[model samples]
Structures are given as structure tokens and as C-alpha cells.
Target chain A: MSARLACFLPLLASLAVAGERLHCVVIEVPSASLPLLREEMKRAAAPVADHGPVLLSTDGLPRRVTHRGQAPFVPEKPIPLGNGPREGSPAGARSFNIVAASGAGGGLVYDVSIQQSPVPASYYDFRTKGLVAAVPANRWQELAAWNQGTRSVSLWHHLQTDEPRAAAGDELRIELIFASMPDDALAHVPEYPPELTRQVVGHLSGTGRVWKSFSLACRADVPFHLQSSHGDRRRRQEPGYGDRVLAKFQGRITRDTPGHATLDGLLEAPRHHEGDAEAYPVSSEASIGEWRLIVLRDGPTFKAAAAAFHEIYTRRAHVAAKVNVVAIRVSVADEGEP
Target chain B: MRCPFLSRTSRWIGSALALTLAAAPARDRLHFVTISRGYDDLLREEMKRMAGTPVLPRSGKLLTGITGFPRNAGYQGTIRLDRDFPLEWSVQRSGTPGRTAGDFGFTLGVMRAGDGPGLRFDVDALESGTEHDFYRMTAESVPLPLGRNTWHPVAAWGSEYNQGMSLWCYREATAVAASTATGIHLLDVQVGFLPEPVVAAMNTFTPEHTRLARGAMAPWQTLSVSCQVDRPFSISSAAGERAMRGRSDDRGLCRLTGTLTQNYETSFNLKCQWQPPGGKKQPQVRFDVPLQPGRWHLQPVEGGPRLRATGPKGEVRVANVAAFRITAAEP
Candidate 1:
């Protein structure tokens, strides 16, 4: 009895891991343009696949299609396909259908049912006979949320060619849908911290790419807000109309060795406007480090500040120093207007 | 004892003859005056008092041949009529071939008193023939309606062969009933050369059509305009249209510098013209080589129009020829 229980325990653990579902998106493209799509996809991080049938369980959930000869049938109504073969039909276990329609121009359109599970590796294999690109369920959910909040997401397929070319007749079309977040779950999300909100002003020094890398760690109790106001000044000074302020902040940097560095920061960008005195905290990490800050500014004020900072840093170490001003404003929350 | 009716007719005829002789010299020496709105109440009374009266300064010569009009009223005190050519005066128009004529052209900068069709005027030049037969050379009549307070520069030139002629810049205030009461007020006036025909053409010339290339190009575009002018001028782009004033050059070539966008349309305006020296018979041509975003060059097309652009791949032609749009195409 103990030996049998041990084997069953391993099987139960595998089922629990496999049960973890992710959001799966399927894109339909012309079979002929798969090669071109593959070339373009190399620039981005997405897995591509071809045409095939998907299996769904009794609860209308996507299940792994184990056999090739599963009942490939289009149901008039959504039905729960049993786990195994039913009394009469041998393929009654597989439900849901991949409906194909004629797309505008000479292309095929497929109505793919988004699966709740992470797409298996076999789905991306071209040898498995399906054409699609599957994004990890967590990443897909984050992208959808970001797209809903900002409305800045754009999707288009580009044709790869050496010479100047027009849009290809047969191209891939990707459609993304954002799932609404529940109000109760959203309450736990923290608002952007005001402490880190500041206009960073500084300069860069030392030539030749071999400059020493250093980082300034923030206290665990307090959140550090690093922002630059250079973008705002540039927008205002630009001539003509349609001036737009572009603000970008790279959160964290990861390094495998002393010289080699990789930027791995999650971007949490809120809509930025001119004179909006608010700073978004870097991350949830208590102690943030492993970043080399390079600040560049011109004029007498910057020069004097840089010289003063350089004198202090050169005394301690052989590292170059940069002077930066973090302009922070205190909010008068209870102040009444007259 | 004498005939009473004959004596009365002879007395009336002798008085009329004396009045006609007195007005003859006043007609030859005409005064052009410009008044402002500040003197509106005193306009009619002043006009009546100054009529047929010569207002000559005590000293200094009358500025007959001055090009630009004086801005201040104090300067008018220093000028007097030329003593030698006091009766026979000639003023040369500025910026044109100085041709002397007997008559003077004046511009009256007047403002309307009320909201009504202010007035209309007919100007006629008195042409005296060799046999003493006089005829009137009338110019196009202009309307000086209320709210339209502009200096309408009109000219009345007699037959080119006639030597004895006088220019008249006149306006009639009787056209409108309201204007007849207030009368047209003359602010300031000076006799000078008749305005050149080129000046009139410059005011009226509007580019109704343009030819440019459409679609995308590697870089650059060329613009050509065929117009008639007598002097050097420039054509440039303004407010998305070719509306900038170009540098004056005898070469009739204009270099336009501006940044261009991809898949967008821009407009240009040709403001002036350049006429080559001793090339009056030659057609007026204005060429604009716009330096847009990328490298652009005028490709030499054998026996083709002078203005053409070449791109990195091939030559381009003006796509919408009538609308003036240039498009990239294989040469």
C-alpha cells in the first residue's frame, strides 16, 4: 500500500503543475507567407505556428490534444466534451471548433478560441503542422492591462524585403483583447509614490566605453523616485505645434559580471503631462542597486555642481562622479482656495 | 436816351468774361490735399476756402520730384512750388523709367464718416491738341464707398503723341446722398509720376495653378514658374504655401530651404519676378530648387522642361501636373 501511494503522489503533483492555465492567443496567417512572418518575428519575441484542431474538456477549458485522430467536429452549441470516449461517439471527448472564414483580400481568417492554459511547446513547432504565435499567459495579461490603461498598443505585420516594397497581399493579423480586472482585486494595488517624483538634472564624464560602473542603493523603508525633466524642457523649446513630452525610465539593471550588464526593469508608465509633479516608485524591491547613472547637463550651474561632487568622489575612489539635482515639491493637501 | 435792355445785357456779359479769365489759371495749378478724421468737422469749410487758391510756402522749393510721400505735417511747411517751373511742372515717378508729364497723380487717404456707399469718382486728363482742340482722356472710375478708406491710385494719361496734357486725380462726392453733405475730405496730396503698370500687375498676379511631384522620393524637388515681369524678384514657400519673398537676383533663380516630411503635401507662392537685363523679349522664368529632407538634384532631361528632379533609384515627374504635385517614378 505504501509503494502504490508513492507512485500516485508523483502523478498527482504533475497534474497540479499542468493544471496551471495561461492566456493563449492564436493568430491566423496565409500558409505561403509563413516564411516572411518568421523573418519579421525574429525581431520580436513571439512563437509562430500553423493550422490545426484544438481540444477542449467538459468545462469548456482547453485540454492537451494527445491523439491525432480525435473527433474533429464543429458543434452548433458549446458542449462539454467528456474526459474519455462517450457511449456512442468515439470523439465525443473533444469539443469546440476552429471556424475558418474568407478574409478581405486573398487570405484565410480563423476564429480561434483563446485557451486559459499556457501554450505547449509542440504548438510552436512548425513540424507539428500549425501556424501561430503564443505569448506567455502572464505576459499577455500584463500587456492587455497596459494596453487598456494607455491605449498605446499597436499591432501590424511588416513585410521583409531588401528593396522598397508595398504592403504584402498575404499578411498575418493579430487581435488582442484585454480582460477586465475585478474591482476587489484592484483595491490592493498601491498608488504611485510621491517621494520619488523629481526632475533629475546632471551630466556625464569620462570617454572610452571602459568607465567604472557604480550604483546608489535606496533605503528599504523609503522608496526612491528617479526621473528626468530634460524631456519637458525639450518639448517646450521645440518650434511649431504638436509638441509632445516623452518620459522614459528604465527601472533596474542586472549584471552577471563586473563589466557585463543587462537592463531588466519592468516599465510602469502612467500618463505623463507637463507640470505634473508626481514620481512613480522604481519597484517593490526593498533595496535597489546594480545601476550606473550617467547624467549630462550644460551651463555654469551644472559645471559648478559637477566639480564639487567630483572632488568628494575622487578622494574616496578612482570612479568618476556626476552631480544631479532632484527637484522635489511638497504637496499642500489640505490647503483651501480663496 | 440809351437802350436800357442792351445796357443790362452788356453789363452781365462783361462780368462773366472776367470770372472765366480768373478761373483759367486756377484750373492749371491744381492743389492736392489729404486730411484726417480729426478735421472732419472743418473739412467742407476748409475745402471751400482753399478752392482755386495756391498755398505756396514763403521759402524753399516745392518737392515736385520726390519719390516717397512725407509722413509728418511739419515737413509740408518747408516745401514751395518751383519758381521756374511754377506754371509748367513735371514730377518723375520713383522706381520706374523717369518720364516727365505735365499732370500730377495724387492719392487721397480719406476715411468715411458714416456707413453708406461713400462716393464715386471719374478722373479725366485734359489733352490739348496743336489746333487748340481739347479732349478728355478718362481712366477707369473708382468707388469710395463708406468703410473702404483706401488710397485708390488712379492715372489719366493723354495720347502718347500729345505734348500738351494735364493729369487729373479727381473724385466726385455727388454719387451718394450722405457723402454730398459731408463731402470728400482730402487728407494730403503730392504730384508725382504716374504709377508703373508693373506695380498694378504685382497686386493682381495670383498663382491659380501649380505643378509638383506626388508620392515618396529619396530626396529633393524642383519648381518652375512661367510668368511675365520687368524686374528681378523671388518666389518662396510661406505658411505651407509658396508665399515667402525671395532674394532679388538677375539670374531668375530662387533657392528655397525648408524641411519636408514623408507622404505629405506642401504649397509655395511666387511673390516677385526677375527680368534679365536687355532681355525684355525673353520670357520671364522663375526656377525654385527647394532643399527638402533628402539629397535632391535637378536631372538634366534632354529636350525636356528645365525643372526636373532625380532620386536615388530613378527620375521623377510631376504627377498631378495641373495641381502641381511631383511623384517618384522610374525614368
Candidate 2:
């Protein structure tokens, strides 16, 4: 009811019996990693590649859903001791530094400091991977939405880890990053890309309900623009499709992944006495449009999640569960493929 | 419906009953919500009302309220300024971590007898005779509401004793800021509870070295400084007058070689004078330093022989090192 009380209520609920294990669900281990703790999934039936991040929803969630961005590990303020040689990961790599949230389940989001990793070769956000955020006015409101039973962040990211015997067992790591909302973008969104609010909710085509909310944000500005190639047209294009119309939406389309993108949604954009055209164009770095929120939540035995994904896409959406982030290992092909 | 005569008699009986109820006054109760400060992170809070030292966890929020104001649910407390100059508000709540932590910054809000929630005092906003000197926050007799829906009256202050140079208070609801002068170092700030005899206990250390600025001294030159007691207060000291002293070497390796007092706010004043390497005005950097209380170290910086002192938590790091800008090697 009160801001103070409301914020604490969920955390309290989480603390109560938060350390429970459900019935075992077998899933493929990172082929490189191996079979999880509980049961095992046949590699043939559970294609790890098809599972992606969206399937972790407990149940009651659609299999195929899109998310813009999901942050797994974020602290109100990160204490940077700034000690030298204190950077990077445990299995050790140097080109980039790793920021850890180990004690909490979330694996550390890599921190790309200008001093350390300047020209990073990541899968998304150009070379850099993360973005800074502004405080939002409605974090409480967003949480209320989750409480109201319409949404849950579990859909976007769900992970469980069956740690080695030396490490503790039954440890689950779920990473989630949300913002109040950004100040600059709130003013900027309605004007330049007037249809973004409607577009994200799938106003154009390929419609679906919001599965599990990945980021509950207020005053959040997660805006980006990606221009693919020439001849990739938008909706209702008249005879005259010039370079300016193509360039106008240059930074409008955004895809954040280390792999190929294939957006499957209706496009919303300006057009004249329209024919069979999308308002926004389907785009990918290569042939055309295909963008989805590159959020990935994994569990130790992600088989149940993989199965859940199959259930959602195949036309069953009554399951309910909160997913989390265990570890997401993206296998990227050569850069030009996307 | 009674007849007119009967109705008149009933009215007389009702009046007599009303007089008896109004004669007895309701007992006033004062419950409180206390916010804790200086925390590493959030933790779970268990509530207890009677203990004098209500072992509050550092740096979090707590709000507790009873049925009435002042007597039953209220407890009195004092805020001693820590070296970090932290200032924030405290209120009681009934839910979640069950508390709300709001950063009042160097300012504070309180509701005393006449003040409720809307009134606030911006301590840093006050200046003495001209509004530019030291600012100590205190309370006023102004009554205001604490929350939007509850228009209860209250008297409040930030965190003041009787003494202060001056204080500025604003009722958040009225949107009006007011200033009151208390001339005493301690000021009274009230929100909900008025804890009497509020005393601040803190360490007040004096630095032996002068403050360093950019480009004034040669890169990486070692300098020595002395410390002496300039002021003392509620803080107890082992070395009565010995201000905690230390030094920095050419390589910027600094060690505070004294059994110095803990938690004292350390600062230094800067003035320039010429000094020859071995003269009486010789740099103190090379001297065997004993941190005797009330002892002064004549420090010389670029203005003379370049004197600098390093405090307990040496603010000097590769980050803020002035010389780093010039001689710092490019990695």
C-alpha cells in the first residue's frame, strides 16, 4: 500500500522459503558443460539452440515472444575499488573485464570501461554491450503489474545451475535489469518514432500477448536505431522510395544479438494510399527485417524450459512460473552471417 | 416521534450525556518511525519498541507508529554527525523491509509538536551573518502536515540542539523556505519525536599538511607535515592535544605512523612561506615524526619546499594525484 511497505513485500515473499527445489525437469547441459543435476534430456528431443531465453517461463507463457532488453545484474551503485589486476573473469580472459554479481545468482554483466575494453567485439550494441539508465517514476507501478497477475519477469530470463559438487548445490542465478525510465527518451520517443509505444506491443502484425515482462521500467529509455541495407522497404511505400526515407529510419530498428536476426512482427510507418506494405519494414543486417528482444534466461536443467517453449509456440499458454538467469553462452558464427 | 414536551425533555437528557463525555480528555500517544543510517546494504529488520539503544542496522529505513502521538509509540533519539557529513530523514512505516529510506542529503525533515511532514530544513542552505558561513540545522515551531492525505499538525526541525549559526526550513506543502538563526553550534531538528539532551559525539582531527591543488608542486616530490589540536568536543582523545599526523613520500607511499584518534574530521589550512632544504624552515618530510598531541608541523608545499600531509584514509590515489596529470606514464 505504502511505497516503503510495497517495495519490501515482494522481497520478503522472496525470502520466505525462497530456497526450494521443484520436481526435476531434465534439459540439455551446455554440450560443452554436460547433463544437469536432476534428470537428463535426450539431446535430440531438446535442441538447446531452439530453447533461447524466452522459454523459461514457468507455464502460462507464450513460447515465441520478443523482448527489447533484459539486464541480469545491476546494483544501485557499484563500488569500484579500482585496484589493478582486479579485473576480468575466473576462467580468465583479458581482452574484456568481467564485473561479477556472484553472491547473488546473477552472473556479472561484463563492464566495458573506456580505459579497459574500448573497441569491443560483442554481439550487440555496436561494439559495447551495456547501457546506463536513469531512475524511473513508476518502478512501484511496474511491480504492481506483476503483482496484479498480468505479467512476470520470469518469462524473459530463467536459469538454474547444478553446480559442481565442490560448489553448493541447488543454487539458481537469475539476472534482471530494469529502470525507472530515462528522461531524454521519454521526451524524444513520441516525436521521432511516434509508433514505438504501439510497435513494441505489436500493433503492426505477428501479434501475441506480453509473455513475461523482461524489464519493468519507468522513465526508461532503451532506444536504438539500426539501418540494414538498401531496397529494404517499409509499409505503404509509394512509387518514390528515396534514400532519405530509407535513411530517415536509420537508427530506428535495433537488434541486439551475437547472431543473425529475423524479426516477425507487423511494421508501422508512414505510407501513401497503401497497398500490401508494412508500416515498419522487417529488417536484419543481411537480407531484411527480423528483430526480437535478445533476452536469454537459462536454468540448470533447461529441459523444462525448453519443453515450455515448445508448448507456447505449439499453442498452449496457461503455464505460470518465474524464470531466471543461470548462464547464457551465445555461440556466434562469423560476423558477416548476420 | 415524541410530543413537543416529551421531545424537549429528551433533548435535555442528551445534552447532559454530551457534557460528561466531553469532560474526560483522550490520552495522547506519540508513535514513531525511525530511519537508520550508515549501512553497507539492505538487511532484514525485526521490530522492538522498548529498548533504549534500539540496535538499528546501519543505513536503512524504519517507520513505527502507535495509536496516538508522543507518549506511547514515540521514543527520543539524537544524531551525532559522522565524518562523512551524512544527513537524511527517518520515518516509521508498517510494511515490507517495512521501511522507506529517503535521502534528505545534507538536509533533513521532521515534525515536532507543531510540525508534521511537509516542513523541511536544508542545513547546507543556511549562512550565518551573510549566509555563506558554517550552517547548523535546527527546528522551528511551525506546524505542518507530514503526508498528503493526513493533514495532522506538527512542530519540527532538522537535527538541532540549542546552538547553531543559522538554519533554513521549508514546509514542502506550502513551498515556502524560511531561515532562523540559533547562533549556537548545535541546532534542534524535529519531525516526530523530541529527544531531549541531544548531543553529537565526533572526532575532530587536524591535518599537518596543507591542501594540494593542481600544477602547484613538482610531480612526486615528498613532503612532510605536522598536526595539532585546533578544536575538541564530545570526542574523547588518548593524546589530548596531539592532532593525528602523517606524511607522504616521493613515491606517494603514505603511512599514518601514529596511534591517532579515530573518527575525527581532519582538515588543514594553507599559507605559503619560503624554505631552504636544510634551514630551520627545512622540509619536515625527512623528520622522524612522533604524533604528539598539540604538536605542530611546519609544512611547505610548492609555495616553498612543497609540504603535504596524508590523512588516515589517504584521499591521494592514482586517481586524484595532481602530479598524475603531468608525469603519469601512459599505459
Candidate 3:
């Protein structure tokens, strides 16, 4: 049979079940160590990737440009300072603001943020080549439509400064990106829901010398169906490399896990005619529906992300010392085959 | 300040009249309300113009009530909407900071009617737009009260809220469904509610973020210019944002006034921050000003942004006012 399916009507009529659901989780991190923690995030974040992190800021940069009753102005150039610092956007806006100001003496003469202009061909090329690009100037995403289907967690102070007693003024500042786990603890996962799409469900516990902890019980399914046909007019777009409907992976782990772990992986690409969803049942006529994930250390970046999981682990890499990378680190769970 | 609702004689008369009208209709005597934080007292006086019953501007703040619904009643845990955000929240990723705005404004809360009031859910702390907010919890949810039967229970209310309450995903304070529950499966169980003021307020401050020109009432002069100075040239290691001061001799006057356009809240006051505007460390000064029209402008002082009064040593005698619009205008 198919996995748990969720059907949403365009409007609020012709629906019989109260299948509505929501989920929330809190991230607990030590507070005092947030300063040092920020450095790790900076180092760990994708380096000048295809896109820059939103609401992301660097520590120690002075926001010099400003006018009374105006936004703090920043220069278009990348600013670097000693300590790494930044404030993530509120869970909804999804981005932080970097105000760039110039001409302080004669008043603000140029503000590209308030108006729109054409970008050069060079700008377009940068984006296509996997470099960070800005949204069209002087505009913001619609506060309502930008994120039509996701939930987030509040960035709460998990508590770094809490002390065991007078003898232990030891400060352990950590940053937590508290957010809801993937929606529908058990979704009728689409053969083609979004990807980098993975999920983890399990107990949350503390681990590591720094007390870093996480779980690998979470599970997420990347779109094997390649459902996007917006570019094609032929037969609702061709199916992807997989002729499957859904792939579910179930596993378990604890706080910051380091390397590899065991997982009962299931790959099901059910073969059925068009409208066979309701009556269609998963058959033993299954193909190679299982595989083993041997996760080495963090792959050349997230390459090893597939087997990339551990329980309550920590590391002291040559580049990143005293860094505590947790087990719940999210990676786009993938399926490989020759 | 003399709001019609504040009148001793009007309260009794208005309440009595509202009661009489309430006898016949559901929402009858809910008179008119005009909220203006725009112009000088000119906009403030609109509340006084009410013939009788009137909803005053900010008679009170939002009365908060808390409730959290568990995905499953038998389940050990509960899912409660955040308080800060009327609806749910999400952390999103953007190409650049503040360039792309996200859609966090959606149905923050929902409830369906039963015999009387419906089962409700309140969404409070929404995820601010961040990586977690955007790719994370973006979808919102509300629970329905089954009352055991799980069926035939009429859904009397369902809708969205955020400003104009009708705009920005229905920013209304509350919603009520139509289609009398004559049956037929809660008939017209609908989603309807406008964004109220508080919802509107939530939309105002976004980490993702604007601009100004002169007002229509008083167009920005190509002749006049402005720039701010923090710490007014202090050689100290630290210089704060401080508007340098300016002044004119006996007969001359320095004015800092501006008009506020519609759709924009009128400012409360224009403040100066710098204790000094000269000396060192490039002056570290930043400040916010609450400006209003009709009359504005700080009294002129030496060594300020507006030191030169559009003339030779404070010589210009131009009759002008400082004004701004919700939108940025051309220079």
C-alpha cells in the first residue's frame, strides 16, 4: 500500500476528515559560548555557495552608514571582523537586512534598496555558476507567499551561562536553531515531495565533552519522481531516473553523532497505472528496494551526507578545533546506484 | 483626547441604543472608527467628529488569551501557536538579507464552531524568517473540536487574519462563517477574517526590511538638503550618532518640520542623539525620529547637520516645512 497520504483542497469545502496537524520542538544550547559558536557557523556554512545564507551576518563589522529614522547602511562589499556575529531573521521573513549607505556628508545620495534597476549579465552568470546573488534590488519577498509550505522554530537562548555552582563559573554558550521537525510526523510522502528532504525522529539527549547531542531518528524523502514538469508540455513531464513512488528510511541516533550508523532503508517505486493510488498496493514484485549506507566522516562537504550520521559525537579537526557537530545535522538523504 | 466613547452622557446613551439594536441584529450598533496617527491633531480629531457611538483609536491593546491544542488529546504533548505571531511562523533562506521577503503571514490560528463557540487554536511565536523559518516550519495548522460525535458538528467559524485584516492574508481580528448550519456538513464552513491593528503591527518590523522624499503637502526642495552627524566630530575613540545642533541669531529661526503622508503613521517626535558632532573616531551616531507635519525641524544650533540655514550664515528666510511620505519619492 502507499504511505500516509495528505490531500489539501484548494478551498475549504468537500473535505470530510480533520486531518490537520502541526509539530513544534525546542532547541537547547548553552548561551555564553554563542560568541565562539558563531565562529563555527561561519566556518561551517557553505563558502560562497550558489546562494548566500539569509539573515546571515558576520561578527565584528561596523554598520557605519545611517541617517536619522533610516535603516543601518552597509556597503555592498563583504565585511570581515575578528569575531563572527549575525542575527538570523524572524522565523517568517527568512532573511536579514544589510543596509548599505554612502555620502553621509551630503545626505544619502544613492539608495539601491528603495528602487529597482536592471542587473548586468555578469550578475546572472554568477547565479547560474552557483554563486550567491541578491534578490532583485529594492524589493522584498511577499511576506505571505515566499514560504507557502514550511514551519520554523524560534531561536531561543538554550542557556550557555548556567552554572553548576560557585566553583563552576564555566560558561558554555551554544546557539540553537529551534524549529519544528518536518511536517506530518508520518506524511503520505509523495513519490516526489521536495528533497535535501529528509527526516529524523527519536529521543533527544546531550553528548560530547561540550555536551553536544542530536538524533538520527528523523527521516526525510527527496523527490524521486522528478515531478517538476513546468518546463515540458509532454505527458505531465517525464518520470525521473526512478520509476518509484516513495522511499522511506528509518533509523535512530542521539545528540551530536559523528560518523556512520545502521538504517533499515526502503526504496519503493510502485508500478501502477495513472489513477492507481487508492487501490494500488505495494508488491513483492519490488525491485532493488534496499541498500546499506556506510557513512564515513563528513564527506567532501555533504557528499558523505547520505551515511552522514552519528550519535552525540564531537570532533577536533585541524581547521575546526573544539567544534561540536551534532548528529541531527540535516543532509539531503540520497539513493545511489550504478 | 475627547473621544466620543469617553463622554459620560454618551456611554449611557450609546450603550442603551446599542442594546436596542442588538435585539434585532447580530452586529448592528458597532459604529464607526477612524484611526489616524498621521497628521497633526487634524487626524487625531476625527474621533471627536463621531456623531455618537465611535471606536476610539487605541482605547486598549489586544486582549491576549492563550490556548494550545494537542495533535492528539490522548497524546502526552501539545502543539501551541506562538503568542508574538498570531499565526504560525517559519524560518526561510533568502539570496541576500532583506532583499526577498517571505510569506510568514498566513492563517496563524483557526477554530470551528460546535453548539456555541468553536474549537480554537492560537498561533503565537512564529519562526522569524531564517533558514529554519523558510525551509522549516512554513505550513500552519489548527485543530477541530469533535465533541465525541466527530460528525454533524457544525463549523460556525473558519478564516485567516493578519491587517486591513482583510488584506495580507485576512488580517482581521476575528471571523464568523455564513450559511446557517441547517446541516449539509457544516454547510458553509469558511475561512474569513481581516488583519487587525496588532496583526498590522506584526507586519511592520521585519528583520528583512525603506525610504523617504518630501510630502505632497510640502514637496522636498531641490534647494534644501539634509545629512545626519553622530557625535558631531568627537576625537574620542567612540562617537555616537548625534544630530549636530544649529541656531539663528535673535530674529532668525531654525525649523525641523515635516508632513506625514497617508498609509504612514505620523511620527511622535524628532530627537537628537549626539552629545558632540566633532573631534575623532569618525563619530558613532545613529538615531530614530518620530516626525509630524505642519510644524517640524529642530531649533538651529552650531555644528549640526542643518547648520547652514539654506543661506549665508543662517540668512535664508524660506517658509518651508519638513514632510515625508510612506513611499520614497524622486529628488
Candidate 4:
């Protein structure tokens, strides 16, 4: 199948009644080559009718998923796709199924099952058990380790309970499949670029799935000396400096989903290394060792993006003895399309 | 031998004439004149009543006159004096029912009457006593006039301790032929205390006698003095002193400018000093001028020893002998 037909097949299969309530099962595909995968799926005669994958492609097109015997439901608004899966319960009632498929490029997929329950419950309640059960037996050990680790994942949940019910008091269940993880999927992890530090001040350039083009240039200066008191033995032994950093990001975002975006970066300094010793009273000398620009999103407005920058840098105590995000500038492309 | 005989005879004749003249006694006559200048009939009657005699002229080798001297209201008296000779004079309170204790003074002097006249002799007697103790005595030469019949001021006296008395005496050149009185004459007599020099100075600047406004720095304020003094003196405000020079008109007028700088309600001591034309001593006179806010007028009471400034609200006298007041103008 061609890339366009592959993107449209999920929409054709999921046509359903607008007001009908039903249980849903969701599966996440980890792949940037969603169009190529669609050709393979067609040749293999996979069950695309009952389990059509919702492709979140870089083309910025909307995809739909519907239940049997129901009319097609199209989203009235653009949905943001790259971050994570979205799930919610209705009035203490729980519903859903989830499954994640791992890809060759170390991209993990999540599978979820949802049931139409009378009382509302959170998906976080079954995070460990349900997720562990959904994984293939051979990958169970790897999934368990990832769950136990400190790495963060990006997942989004959105719940809508206003639709009409098929029964007088019966709750509805809806299923959704998220495929084609964006090239920027790794950027969604809360603490990305782990153990990776860039220069104290440098330029950042990356393409976003939602925002087609992205570039960030920044210069940071240590305006004040960060001295730890002698009474604070830990800080005295490991002194740090505070900094005032300035950053500017320019990019173009899809016009339909325009809103505020965020930029996150990391700053790190080394502690004195003693000879074969883990700790010491004081280090010989220290400097800002690294700075990493993890993610930059085109926010709705420049002011909003700058405010987000200020909010992040001001609250961190370890960035320096003191830290200030002095200036921030964000400019949106005037093309108005993507 | 013959010339000696003639000289001895002439000497004997001159010696006999000298002996005859030496036996004669010196002739001195005391004359008195009654002054009617600037007096009313009521005052003359009051003076007559106080003197226990009619205000009449007494003629003798020494003429005596009973004249009315005006002081404050209810203070009028008779002054009895020898017209040409220096003599003693006394003023005993009339044993009247409403008589009040007061001060009085008498001044007798002889002065030359001419373009460049001068006082030859002057005597002054002042007393602040009751009916029994108030009296004055002076023996001075009568004033001589350089011109015939030229009237020259001779005596001046006043009292305001209890009741007011302002009296003056003048000698006409005719009096010089009547009696051999050759001494200083008093020119002006004021019964009450002298009007504060500053107050008098301000009065010359404006009849309203308005006090300078506090912090009034503007058109310079100028005062002209026409008193009898001959030399220039100095006047000062808080801004400091400026010398007052005599006007070119030779009217004995000294003009002073009060350059005001700031608001001052305190007493300003205006000092004036000058040496007599040919005298070695410099007499310095100071007046305490009280400064307040308002319009003022110098009120010289006829009898009292208090110089007062009458404003729209009321009157204020120099309460302290050392200081007078300057009040603010009426709004």
C-alpha cells in the first residue's frame, strides 16, 4: 500500500456511531517508518479491520479509530500525537486495554485493555501488573527491569464522558491505537539526555514531530560566585557556581495545534575527585562541566515560552551556587502552515 | 618835675572815679513770659485751677508768666517761670480729687539764634515724684540771638510718670535787651518717653505705620529722618546695617533703607550714633523696635512716658525699654 492509503485505512475500518459507548483497547507502535510498515502489514494480511493501527505520521494528518456498527467519529480539533498515550476513567468506573510493541530501533510499545466498569479507577493502579502481563513472555524480563528503573516515560491521558450511552445507565468504552512514534519521541522522556552534557553555552538544533523546524541558540554566564558555607559540609566539600543564562529558540509549528511549548536543559558540575576516596572535605577546583539542551517546543506565544524558561531555571538550586534565566526569546514562523 | 605833677593829678582823679563805681552793686533782673502758643482755653483754665491762681501775667523787674502745659488727657498744668533770668520752678499736684502720681521734668537753656546757631548752656531736671516732691531748679544764662527779634527755642520740659506734661520755652531777641540771659535754650520737649527711634523712622516712611511683612523682600523700604541731629547715622535690619546720609537739601534729613531679607518677629535694635560737630564723644542711641504683623501708627500720648503703636486691633507700647515691636500688615 502507498503511504497515503496506509494512513487512511485505520480511518475506514473504525467508522462508528457518534453517541455509542463501548469498551476500547489501545496499542502503541514504536516506529518512525510507519509508511513502510503499512506495506508489510498489507502483504502479511494482518487483521487491519479489527485492529487497525492509528498512524501518528510526520505529515500532520488526523487519524481516527471507531467501533463496529458505529458511524465514523472525526475529531473536531487537532490532537497532539507525539508525547504519550492518553486514558481516563468515568466517575470511578475503569475501562480499557493497552499493549506496547517494541521495535528494532529500541522503541518500546505499550498495550492497554480497558473494561467498562461501574466505578472509576486509574490506569496507574494497574501500571505494573497490566503492563507486565501485556508484554510477550520473552520480553517480560526486560519490561520488568524498565519498570523498576528511574527512567521516565511520556504518556498523556484524555477522558470525555459527554457522549450518549447505548443503554440507559451503561458506561461507554472506547479503544485507540497510537502508531508511528515521532523522531522526537526520546525528547518526551522527562529526564532525557541522561548523563549527556553539552558545552556551557552552545547552539541546539532539532526537528520536532509537531513543530516541523526547531533551533535554539543560547549563551550563559556565571554572574556571581556560588560559595557554600563551611557549616554545610557537603556543599563545602563540593562547591558550585550560579549562572544567568539567556536562550532563544525559533521554529514553525502546525497552525492547527498551536499552543504554548516548553524547553528543558541540564547543567552539571564535577565534584573534586579524591585519590581512591568517594568523598573529601574540599575539592581542589571546579567549573561548570556540562550543559545539555534536551527539548525545545514552539509554544503558542513568545511570552509564554520565555515564562516557561524562567520558571525552570529559577527553581533549580544545584545549577550554580545561584542560577538565573535572564533572557529568553522565541519567534514563530510567519508561513502559518506548518 | 612839672610833667610828674600833671600825671599825679590825673591818676588821683581816675582813682577816685574807680572807687565811686566799685561801691555800686551788680544789677540783675528776672523776667517771665506766659506762653499761649498751641494751647486751648480749657487747658489754660485747668492750669489756672492747678496753680491756685488765675492764668495771668505778672510784671516785675523779673516778669513771671503762668502758662498751660499739655500732657495726656486730664493732665494739664501751669508753668511759672522767669522770662529772662535763670531761676527755680516747681509743679505740685493740685490737691484735686482725681490727681494721679506722675513724672515731670524742666529744661532751661540759652542758645544762639543764627544760621550756625549753637547751644551755649543747657540745664535739665527730671523728677518722678508725688505732689510734695516734684520740683526743678536751674540757674542758666538767658539765650542770645544773633539777629534782632529772632525767636530762639530756650527751654523744653515734660513728664509722663503719672500724668503727661510737654512744655517748651522760646526767647525772642527782644528778651536779650530786657535781661542779660546768655545760655543754652531747650528746643523741643516731649512729656512722654521718646518715641522709639525705629518706630519714628517707620512712621516717616508711611503714615499707616504698617509693620513690614515677614519675609518681605521687595521694593526697598526707605525712611527719612528730619530730627535735629547734624551727622549721618546707621540703620540695620536682620540683613545688617546701611549708613543713612543727610539729604543734599540740607534739611537735616537722614534717609535710611531697610532691606528686608527674612521674616523676623523678634525685636530689632536700631542703633544711631553720631559725634557732635566739634565734640570728642560719640553718643549712641538704640531703639527696640518690636516686629509683628499688621498696620501700625505711632501714638505719642500727651502725658505718659510710654510710646505706643496703634494698629487696627489695638495699641501696643514699648513694654521693654530696650525693645519695640514691628507688627505685620492687615490682611
The Cα error of candidate 1 at residue A320, in Å, is 25
Candidate 2: where is the Cα deviation over 4 Å? A1-338, B1-32, B38-331
What digit string (tens of lDDT, one per residue) describes model 2 on residues B156-186? 1111111212111112222222332111111
* Model 1: CA > 4 A from native: A1-276, A279-338, B1-331
Evaluated on chain A only, model 3 obtains a TM-score of 0.17
Candidate 1: which docking quality band? incorrect
TM-scores vs. true structure, each candidate: 0.16, 0.18, 0.16, 0.19
* Tens-place lDDT digits, model 4, residues B137-203: 2223323322222222232222222232223232222233343222211112111222243323334
Task: Evaluate model 4: give its TM-score.
Answer: 0.19
Worst 10 residues of 4 chain B by lDDT: B61-70
* Model 2 chain B: lowest-lDDT 10 consecutive positions: B193-202
Best by lDDT: 4
CAPRI class of candidate 3: incorrect
- TM-score of predicted chain B, candidate 1: 0.20
Q: Give per-residue CA lDDT, model 4, range A169-230, as digits (tens).
A: 11111111111112232233233232221210111111011111111111111111111111
True contacts kept of 1: 0.00
Candidate 3 per-residue C-alpha lDDT over A128-219 given as tens digits, one digit per residue, 9 for 90 to 100: 00111112122111100000011111111111122221211111111111112112211221221221112111111111112122111122
Note the DockQ of each predicted structure: 0.00, 0.00, 0.01, 0.00
